[model samples]
Target: MARTKIIAGNWKMNKTVAEATSLVEELKKELATFEAAAVVLCPPFTALVSVARLLQSAPRIQLGAQNLHPAPSGAFTGEISAAMLREAGCRFVIVGHSERRRYFGETDAFLREKLLAAVAAGLRPIFCVGEELPDRESGRWPAHLRSQLQGALSGLSVDALSQIVLAYEPVWAIGTGRNATPEQAEEAHALLRKELEALHGATVASKMPIQYGGSVTPRNAGELLAQPDVDGLLVGGASLDAGSFTSIVFAVQ
Candidate 1:
């Protein structure tokens, strides 16, 4: 089966409820005639319900969460669980974003727990795995990616793995406006496919979507989307703007 191209916006900490409504309304209108790729908006937790309601009629657009806790119910103050996210009307959830892994000291093992929780709770997870500048500079990023993938996704069965999406957002590139080159993204994506095949099998690996999430802009979106191994994108800053985000989606088509 061919993998569908997905463009998921990771709206981290931005957009008030009213602002989010306006944005999604605009997207619903602008993209109403658009039906090329799978689109998702990951607004802040406070905006999930509002955005989800707005996107209900837009079948091509899906609602996603930025982060969630591993447990179903717990006293983990300030932490949102997968169940809560589902209740908020989210069909997808981002797991192991670099910001969370770096700032919150989330280990690979910890992310594995989160991925498991998200999957078990019926929300599909866009599992992020990538490396920082130092790792890339030392030419050890591939090894790091291998270890990360093994630690986080290897234990899952093929059925669960098939329901997941993999995102490669080089740590040094996420918000710096310096995205990896098309060749670079392809190289990383191809490596991820290899890893997935080893962990599961060729059939599961072939259909898994590997998204590129860094400093993606409409200017470079076309080139990146053209990569055979780059199945989609996990857009950040640029996704906040309706025009720019729309342009990126069109780039896929």
Candidate 2:
């Protein structure tokens, strides 16, 4: 079975409710022309409820959350639970983003817990896995990525694994005004698929969708999405603007 393409935007701490509403409205208008791929918008926690209300009747576009805590509920003062995200009309949740790992000290153990929570809440988990520049340069990319994949997804069943959407985002490329070369991105994507096959089976791995993230834009979207192993993209900066994000969406085909 072929994997469905998923073009998701990580709004990251940006956009107010009003700004999110306007952006979603414009995106809905532009997305009406393309129906082959799935589009998801992840707004900050502050805007999720409003954005969800705004897109109540929209069919093709979906809502996602940028982060979620592992526990369902607790004294975790600064964190939101997967259940809360679902309540806000979120169908997906991103776990273990590089920034979360770099800034908040999210370890593989913590990510695994969060992934389990997201799965239990019936939310599709888009697990972000990648290697830093120094690791890649030192030829430790494979080991590093393998460690993360193994550690984060060790206890998931084949069915649970199928629900995951893996994203290979190079730490150096994210928000650095630099994008990975098509060849580099394809290589990482392919490697990730192989790791999945080794951990799970060929059947599960073949159906799993692997996306490329990190400075993706309209200018490079087509070439990157055309790669055999690349199912879609986890767009960042380019996705903040409706016009550019829609253009990148069109570029997928």
Q: For residues 95-211, could you state the per-residue lDDT of candidate 1 as single tens digits?
A: 999999989999999998998898888999999999999999999999999999998986887768878999999999988988899999999999999988888889988999999
For candidate 1, the per-residue lDDT at 48 reads 92
The per-model lDDT (C-alpha) reads 0.93, 0.91
TM-score of every prediction relative to native: 0.98, 0.98
TM-score of 1: 0.98
Candidate 1: where is the Cα deviation over 4 Å? none
Error of 1 at 81 (Å): 1.2
lDDT of 2 by residue, 1-253 (tens): 5789999999999999899999998988888767888889999999999889877767888999999998889999998998999999999999999999999999999999999899999999999999999998999998999999999988789878878999999998999978899999999988988888898889877998999999998999999998989999999989999989999999878
How does model 1 fare in lDDT? 0.93
Q: Model 2: which residue pairs collide?
A: none
lDDT winner? 1
